[model samples]
Target: MATWISIEGHRRLVEIIPNEVQELWDKWEIRGLILVSLVSQLILIVLGNRRRYKPNICTRALVWSTYLLADWVAAVAMGAISSNLGEYYENNHKKFSKYYINPQLLAFWAPFFLMHLGGPDTITAYALEDNELWLRHLVGLLSQTALTLYIIIMSWKGNWLSHLTIAMLIVGIIKYAERTWSLYCGSIQHLRDSFLRTIDTSKKIEQQQESNNDGMNFWEFLANSIQKDFENEERRAGDPRNYLRAIYIFVSLFADMVLSPWDITQDRKELHDRGCFHWSTYFTLVNNELKLMYDVFYTKAFANYGIQGLISRLVTLITTIVVLASYCKLSENKEHQVVDQIITYLLLVGALLAELSSFFFAVFSRWTRHYFRLRGSATFCCILGCIIDCFFTKSRVHISMGQSSFFTIICNKSLIIKGNFFPVNKLEKLSSVSHRLTSEHVLQKVYRSLYDKSERSLQSNLSGVPGYRSLLLEKNKPIFASEVEFHRTIITWHIVTDLCYHFYDEPSYHFDPRKNSKEMSDYMFFLLVKQRQMLPVGAGLITLRDTVIEAKRVFEDINVVTQEDNLGEACRKLLERSTTIPRNEDLRMQSTSILLHACDITNELIADAGEYRLPMWDFVEELWVQIISYAGAQCRVDMHAHQLRRGPEFLSHVWLLQAHLGLLDQFQIIPH
Candidate 1:
């Protein structure tokens, strides 16, 4: 053990040492690159896996930068090494060249660059568009493979190191191929095609089974058949391995098919009515299932499946270990530089550790346990599944306040849009408003300005407010006549919700939904102005800019110059001064007072629900959920497609969820 530590310490020190006294050059470029590649692999493996656990902009950007740099650094290293060869050949040809150093080690290192290009399995594509670059990657695979091969042949003679290089080249090609193929499978078109094939095979088998059993009444036969089919599908959905495949089946079947809300409800009627799970358990299960869907569309998960992928990974791991062992054994006769030797060892060790981590992640994965269970391997299933269950239980127990809200917002955001008070103070403050945002008056004054502008259609055309000619609405028509109309409703109700909350007098009446409601409302507005491409066509940003300008002018007139942090206290003081402003006050000030009065009218409307009365927020929460879900479904698929260049937007996921729920009109099956 002492001797081993001494050798390891020597290897560490050699990494920073110069190769030769006469040559002033440190020969550190290749060493620096190898370290960068190793670091990149570790960063991606750790960060990429955590992405699904938290969906924030900062985390997304971190993963995005690391992912792109992984490939870029490795590719650039290859170009550098290739350039070094020209210099290597020139220096060695000089007859009196005592300073010309042999570059066999550099050439030997080329194959590892190909291995780095393979990337970690934790992430293949940062976004949907990355998968579309599979063809370009394929071209890269061929070009880089040839370049590495050429480097090895021209620079190194057939020695023991040459044999090791060949071994590494084989492993590198396999790794690169796996990544390219994974990218192909992750592509939306490829997934859709795979789904079609699975459906066709299932139908053929079902037809054969039905032909063998006959002589029953049509209704009796149909009912029994449907029951059996549902049971089979339910069992499949219950298993982690099959659940993803099952999702693909439904997604492919319904991508362009249409059905109504009632149809979707009826389809899931049996599961809801007779399933063993409660609503919360069912919600957890669906979330897990959708997470798999997210991976299929956005990551290299689909490529990691099947018997072939398992064998390829196993071979790559074994070959990497073999190469490391071979190099150490052969190093006894070689005069290799200390830094170069350390880099080779680091590359090999990094590969071994990365592969091991991936294996552990897979073994304890829900998919692995389900696979074992389906195959009747009770002992393995119980052990691995127990470990996974315990891990998740501990994770849930450690949930912090912020993580709780973050996850809740992600799962529920796609479900609804409600009229909640989204305070501007919580986020960016108006440059014009000197007061902190805790007061109703701050928002009320702004809403009042919007209300007046809305009445005269100044903001209507700005946000593309729907102009319906008829007074009566048709059955099954959208509740909001236009996208702009829905936008106005959102603004109006936001102010109302805030005022009602502030004026309610009872300190004990606070609810979680009401608190969370403001978050959702603010986030939606954030998406509206900032992520407008994800929503329907509108001039929301322009209108919002106009509102900000007018609100700033109002702030200057009121002479209420308070810092943003003090706005809450300012609002409390304002409310205490008078419930009704003086009649001689500016119309804008009166608008603030009138909007507060409107909140009273809203409170009265909800106070009269019959026995078993619902809280005002309960209705508000449900209403917004439906409204947001509707708006999500209303966005164009083209818009969703365009934004795939960035990471998957929450709005796109909601759009897909609406399609799964049969809420979209695009579900009608097209004839061939």
Candidate 2:
């Protein structure tokens, strides 16, 4: 240790008597630090292999990993002096460049980072799976862009590396822009959904309020509220509206589950009554929704730019131009080229980190607004991690699957195998046995239902009111009541379909899992395999079915599509203040249960038909059964209901998305 100097009367310790004598503490000594860094890298790999640490601790492991890797590599050219004294001796003859700065390596790896960002439609995020997590992806991409630009600058003299990096950047920007556009389109769909829901609710409430003033009983009032429609000015007392309503519900979901096979293509025809929106309506919807999404998407950029676009753009442009000029000028200085490289690299790194920080502020602002819950916020964080490669060490990233890497053509042409939801989905042969086991069930229920005669009488009286029709005996009614009966049914097949292996995982969810099966069992597996979510069409068709049911219970006839009236008997078992109940009471967990269950039923049907793993589209047959059941029932009850009401149109669109995504078991083709 060096002695301290004292200026007062106290005895002073001697400093280095001469500048040349201090040379011992220079370049050669740096070797030890470099060696320590190398040792640390090996230690980390060992510990990671031994399963001694967690991947997402957000500290310790991740920090030390990056520091060790970056610094160790940096020690190369830096540690190259002939001796520690040479570092400071001003050796004019030495060119201090390292051969390790290979342009080919940088050229190969930079773009691989970007390819990892595509984000599946089934699950657009990792780190956080929430739909709102896209904001994080945007930020991560931008940061990576800045970092890549810095590396590109350093390697610009290497023409091939420079050109490759530029090409990757262009492709990356285009891909990112496309994903943003897709998400924007989805947001538009969501807005349309909200609008339709509002309109339906408003009209229903208005009619009910009028009924209450007329002194109708509570049952009557509820029924009227459930069924009334405002769009039709020519609804009649005994029209065939109920039949149309049922068929619409059956047809929409059936079509979505079958021929369409994806949620993105849900058609307007599937909505209860909202046909293809007029061109003007479509444009207005797109513009408004896009405007709203953009506000949400670019919120961070806006904040950084003082919440004004013109100012932000001008400032960014001016700043970038100034930076480029400075960089170019600095590059021409031969004496300070090394210094220039380090400064440029530092600036680039700093800017990227700043960009990331800024991205969160914008995303967090929205996360705060929409989720307002811990899980939601956490989801955003997780998604951010998934979209950005920053969380994982370089060794862990799946270079092949990344956004910036060479595009690959993976052919994982297989899907997850599944089975049926319940006994009802068993094959005709097995169903025979299933039915025998339950033969006494129907008779027992019929007589049991009669025991509640008083309730039925009350319901009948309510349904028979002047303007409304009876729920059960409507002019057009259920060809069979089973369509409505499966309302509360549970389906667990969707989860099974997600088991197909992911091919392009760069950083496997588990870094060390040789000894822990539990760790293997439940994990955030970063896979290219598709996860699951609800389709707009499934939700829409279900909505249409529910709307029709609500209509029958509230209004007596389909002719009253636009009439504001009451069916005293038909009422929901329960009502939420806003937002109707879903097909299943999935308060949490996830939404693709129906699709999953459908897959199960198909599997079961296929199993019974022949071999277990065969491509028996028998599941499609069962789907048709359901479609026909609902369609026939709706056609039968046409004269029974009082009103013809419209349902959410977005479900049709979701159905289309499902079809497009290629998990098409629910949708099947039936030839004439």
Candidate 3:
């Protein structure tokens, strides 16, 4: 009779809690949730303190950190309120049962925090490789936060958290093993290959100098040659682009090596993201992906809309707030609560099916890459293949990424591009040649702005029309002294897009056509033009619009600076270094150049209507110019922002200049 009464009270507690739970919010469990939230918030402050900013930090850090900081506090508030329900239950063991979903909500929130933890931000400028320690610590923090929340949530289901401690231990061990495998695949061997090759080239130079019996040492001799080679240098024989290419080769190679481990990661994430999108399309692809495992997928355990996975993470906060409010609304609409249940059941089934499909698809994707591509990242694909083999045959849940031989299936993940071609090893299509042909207007306008007699030099080069092979080889010769500076910015984009979006080509992104790019492309043909000269301009334009839009959207984004006070430093840099666009014509000409390059390459790639037959040098020039204009903008923005105490203040100068250039519309400035 006593136990029955206690169970009845425990059951009744669910009805009483939400209304009265706020009374005892300072209890241990509530305090624990608050501690977790506080810790998560601190992590953001610390990350910011570390100054681990990537090239595109504005979008990744500011946006993601603000969201995490705000939502984390909200999660804590929910936890505190939910924990107060313990007072209503007569049985101590069933104390927190009313708040069964609270910890689950926290788990659902944990992943978003983790996802943003080490996103796209660079720990170092002019470098592509992320520090291993940073990555490991981030992984540890993410995994621990997720596991702790999952344990608390799953505690209510069957107190399974206590037992799964063993499973967690095993997973941890396997993950460590996976990390070791990754380190090997992204070995430093490839990056050093170029350095070794360069050193050997230098060695030959040294030997030639040594055999001369000149009074100079190896260093002196090399310096002399470099100086002598620097003067009146016409047809650069060795790599004029060497210093930059050397740095870029390492940056790209290192980034590539680090990312190679992600082939397996890409496969899993690709499958997972695909599953999320699958929900949009009524889960048809997800269903087809895992139709064989319907029995495992159709389990009653997953009969809840919010599960501890990717999809739930996306919808959890808003959905939870809605449901909590609906608790009050549902009293009046009690009949409709039944409808909510049915709809939830159906949605839960869809989510479960999607997850089940993803895990399974992740399994086969590795095997397919392994058996077919034969570019083995590890043996785990084989193991995963076997596990899937057993599951299909036995009708049981044998889901595991480790069933494969290696941990790298994530690296070859699919992007969501609906293009006609299949996924290639590294998005292998180069920007085609005709793309180099900048706008005709740009060619006409260059001498009119920068120099007069220089036009004769530019026109001669423009008309020379070097063969595609010769010009392509010419690009390997030389560029500006800061080629490393240029390459770093460009490769940084490669890492993020490849790692995050799986390098999906944004075909719909509004780039100007080839005629437009021509204005910019002509700059490449100038006597001043050299190899890999366009990266700075390319990355800059890439994110300029986003920055302008963000600044407009936020009230606080407006940085108040007088000419000498706020905008002076930036104004000086723009003036001195020529980062400025003096007139709208200058911009229009450049925009035309970018369009010309874009159209030319795109046409060559598509053979779309095949109108223009741009020579090869012209083609390469267009591509370089397109990338350069965008990259140059990024490098300039970075340089400006680096000298500031506050970033917005630094960027505020860009706006001032944009106004000067008559690009106020592009910068979106409104009058006070």
Q: Pick the candidate with the highest TM-score.
A: 1
lDDT of 1 by residue, 1-672 (tens): 011123565655323433363233324555677788789888888877666554456777878888888888888888877776777676565631443335677777787788778877777777667878899999999999999988887777889888888888998888788789878876767655654454444445456454643333212232233334455644532444334333432345323323333324434443334345433333234345445555555554544543345567678778888888888887853585555567778888888887776656655566555544444468987797678878853321111111011112212223222332233332222211111122232122222322333235311332122222121032132432222345545544454444344444334235644554444455455556445566666544443433333333333445544343344443344344334434355554423323333333344533543432335555544444444555666676645554543433445444554443333445432223
| Backbone clash count, each prediction separately | 13, 85, 82
On lDDT, the stronger of 1 and 3 is 1
Query: Which digits, one per residue and each the tens of the lDDT, describe model 2 over residues 1-672?
Result: 343566666666557434443343332244333444434333432332221112233444554454335323433323232232233235442432321223333332344234223221111211111224556546755765666565555446654435544654554444344344434323324334533443344356655554433443212222232244223545432122322222222323322222321121232222213323232222223222222223323222222222232243334334434444544554444533363355344433333333333334433342222221212245654564354335332322110100100001001112111321222111111111100111122222212222233223312121112111122224242321112222212111111111111111223233211111111111111110111021111232232223223323222232322111221111111111112324455522432223323223333433454633222222321222222222222221111110011111121222222222221233233223
Worst 10 residues of 3 by lDDT: 399-408
Model 2 scores what on Cα lDDT?
0.29
What are the per-residue Cα lDDT tens digits for candidate 3 across 1-672? 011123565665333344344434423354444444444434433343233112134644653455355345534544443333334333453655433323332332333222222221111111112222335544554555555454445434443323333333333333233323232222344334534443444446545543642333222323333333334435221222212121222222222222122222222223233333312121122212222111111111111111222243234323333433443443343433353334333322332333344333433432232222122323654565566556643332111100110001111123222322223322222111112222333333321221222223322221123222233345463321112323332232222112111111223123233332333332322211122221233443222222222222221223322122223332223223322223356544433112222212332333422433234324433444334322322333223222221111212222222211222122222223
Candidate 2 Cα outliers beyond 4 Å, as residue runs: 1-307, 330-332, 337-479, 483-672
**CA lDDT of every candidate:** 0.53, 0.29, 0.29
In angstroms, give how far residue 555 of model 1 lies from its true place.
Answer: 4.3
User: Candidates 2 and 3: which is better by lDDT?
Assistant: 3
RMSD of every prediction: 12.4, 25.0, 23.8
